[model samples]
Target chain A: MKLLEDRIKKDGQVLPGDVLKVDNFLNHQVDPDLMFAMGEEFARLFQDEKITKVLTVESSGIAPAILTGLQLHVPVVFARKHKSLTLVNDLYTSTVYSYTKKVSNEISISKRFLDADDRVLIIDDFLANGQAVMGLIDICEQAQAKIEGVGIVIEKTFQRGHELIAEHGIRLESLAKIAALEDGKVVFEKQNN
Target chain B: MKLLEDRIKKDGQVLPGDVLKVDNFLNHQVDPDLMFAMGEEFARLFQDEKITKVLTVESSGIAPAILTGLQLHVPVVFARKHKSLTLVNDLYTSTVYSYTKKVSNEISISKRFLDADDRVLIIDDFLANGQAVMGLIDICEQAQAKIEGVGIVIEKTFQRGHELIAEHGIRLESLAKIAALEDGKVVFEKQNN
Candidate 1:
């Protein structure tokens, strides 16, 4: 977590309207070593939950989720933003509104991949307003799957995402929690440990 | 490679119109152990290239590309299919037509991540018609980066993708070379080695 926090401090760009650009090591461009380390940390945090599957949205979340899957020895399922030809039917779909993109995307996962007997761990790159995480949680509920916990690479603690997941009674862990972005700088939350 | 081929034969579904649905392992729901093995194989194949970066498109390609980056100890950059708010300018963009999706996507990579001094290895989940791979190659050319080779998880040898890369004079290595889909079965090309 310290590694991520440090890297964020060094490279994370704070833009207007609460935009933190981490494309250098996350989002667009990725650091596989950092992803692996984060995955190991997530595995360590949720090792006791008996997670059967790691679920995430497409594009950004795939990298970290797959690495977490590698560490936990579980299958990684990514919900597609676009409805491809092969993925037309038998899907659990949810609509998520993105404040940054200013659009609502219909995220879907094939029903065959998730089921009632599975324990799911949701992972994502960032949790801003919690719409995306809530969408994944919606899919999990549709499949009647047990929600184990949520792991986030970077979280904005000033946002409502934290409280939303907490409202669902699901344990949430973030590698780097940004307390606030003040005067073009990132303020991290105090670590409990 | 044998492990991948075996898994493909077991779990890969050959749909209508030469479509091989590998969502069970390689696409939608991913098996991270197999991905790590494929990544290791790719790393071994391009070990001498001194790869500074691994490039691929978003979503499906992220899993293997990140794993490959992990093995090679380099950063992985995934071209975004959809332009987000933060990634609007200073990009190396190319248009790629997806036969499966029947759409042309303008994929772009931030100019900040790639440079002329970088040695890049392009990795992707599937090489069907080679449009996606060609798009990445175009971006690499724009960046003036040295492309060491291309690594594919599954290559339809019967398609034009292999020949297209060959025509570009780029070395390509596919973990599974699919020969044909006959009578709802996946027939892999005979391995030379």
Candidate 2:
């Protein structure tokens, strides 16, 4: 977590509209070592949850989720933003609005991947308003799977994501929690530990 | 590679329109141990290429690419299929046609991540017509990066992907090379080794 916080301080760029760009090593371009470490941390945090599957959204969330799957020795399943013609099975669908992309897209996971018996661990890169994770949670509920925990890499705690997940009585853990970004500087909440 | 081929034979579904679904363990739901094996195999196959970065498109390609990056101890950068407002600078863009989605989309990589001095290895889930890899190759060309090789989890040799990549004079290695899928049964090409 310290490594991620330090890296964010060094290379993360803050644009207007609460955008924190970690493309140099987190979003577009990824640091595998750091990401793997973060994944291990997630596994450690949720070690007792008996997680059966790792779920995430496509694109940005795939990196940490795949690494976490490796650490937990579980299968990683990512919801697709686009519907493929090849995918003809009954899918559990949930709609998520992306403020960054300025579009609302339906995310889906094949029914074959999730079921009532699954203990799902949701993972993602960044948490803003928690809309994406909420969508994932919606899909999990549709499959009747137990939500073991949610792991996020960087969280904007100021965006009401923390309160939303807490209100749902779901456990949430993030590697780096950003309280605010002012004048290209990141503000961190006091370490909960 | 043997493990991958075996898994494909066991779990891969061959559908009409040349669709071979390994989503059970490769695409939609990823088996970490098997994916790690494939990544290690890729590292071994291209170990001498001195690859500085691993590149792929988003969604399905991220799993293997991230694993490959872990084994190689390099950064992994995925091209975004859609432009985001966060992306404000010039990008290395290429248009790729997806038979699965029935859409042609332009994939772009931020110019900040790739450079002329980098040696890039492109990784992907499957190769049917080589459109995705070709699009990645175009981006690499735009960045003026030297391409070490292309790594694919499964290659449908019955398609023109093999020939197209071969014609480009870039080294390509596929874990499972299917010669054909007749009568819902997969036929594998002779292993080059």
Candidate 3:
């Protein structure tokens, strides 16, 4: 977590609209060694949770989630943002609104992947407004799967995302917690895990 | 390679219109250990290429690409399929046509991530018609980067993808080469590496 927080401080660009551009290392261009370290941290945090599956959204989350899954020896299931020809019906579906993109996408997972017997740890690249996490939680609830916990690479504490997950009584662990972005600089939340 | 071929034969389902659905292990529900093995295999195949970077498209390709990057100790850059608020200009762009989805996607890589000094190894989940690989190659060419080779998790030899890459004079390595899908079954191409 310290490594992540340090890397974020060094390379993260604070853009307008409270957006922290970590595309240099986290999203668009991924540092696999750093991702492996984060995955190890997540695995260490949730090692005793009996997690059967690791859930995440497509694209950005897949790198961290798959790495975590490798460390945990579990299958990683990524919820698809686009409805492809291969992914048809018999899915656990939920709608997620992206405030940045200003669009809502129907995220889905195959019904065959998650079920009542499964315990899933949801992982994602960032947690801001919590819409994406909530959508994943919605799908988990529909599948009757137990929510073990949620692991995030970066989180904005100033946003309502932390509060929303807290309201659900879910155990949330974010590697780097951002308090605010002021004058093109990142402010980290004190006493972060 | 044998492990992946065995996995495909065991869990891969052949659907109508030549769609081999390996979502259980490859795309939707990913087996991380298997992915790590594939990454090791890929690293062995291209060990001497002096690859400074691993490139792929987002979503499905991220899993294998990240694993490969982890093993090679190189940075992995995934081209963004969607134009987000944070990803502005200064990009190398190309269009990829997905025959399965029947759509064309504008994929872009940040100019900062790739350059002429970098030697890139392109990785993808599937190489069907080679459109996605071709798109990545185009972006690499635009950046004046030297392409080491292309690595694919599964290659449908019956399609034009293999031929396309061959015509480009680029080295191509596929974990599992599917010769054909006959009577709802997958047939492997003879004499596969």
Best by lDDT: 1
TM-score of chain B of 2: 0.95
lDDT of 1 by residue, B37-63 (tens): 999999999999999999999879999
Q: DockQ for each candidate?
A: 0.94, 0.87, 0.92
Q: What CAPRI grade goes to candidate 1?
A: high
Interface RMSD for all numbered candidates: 0.5, 0.7, 0.5
Give the candidate order by descending TM-score.
Answer: 1, 3, 2
Relative to the true structure, how large is the alpha-carbon lDDT of every model? 0.93, 0.90, 0.93
The local lDDT score (0 to 100) that residue A178 gets in candidate 2 is 94
Pairs in clash, predicted candidate 3: none
Model 2 lDDT tens row, B24-129: 9988899988888888999999999999999999878888998899999999999888632445467888889877768888899888889999999999998998
Model 3, span B135-193: residue lDDT tens = 99999999999999999999999899988888989999999999999999999988722
- What's the TM-score of every candidate structure? 0.97, 0.96, 0.96
The TM-score measured for candidate 3 stands at 0.96
In model 1, which regions exceed 4 Å deviation?
A83-89, B83-89
Please tell me the TM-score of chain B in candidate 1 relative to the true structure's chain B.
0.96
- Identify the candidate with maximal DockQ: 1
Lowest lDDT 10-residue stretch of candidate 2 chain B: B82-91
The residue-by-residue lDDT of candidate 2 on A1-193, one tens digit each, is 8999999999999998888989989888999999889989999999999999999998889889988999999999998885323454688888888787687888999999999999999999999889999999999998999999899999999897778888889999999999999988899988866
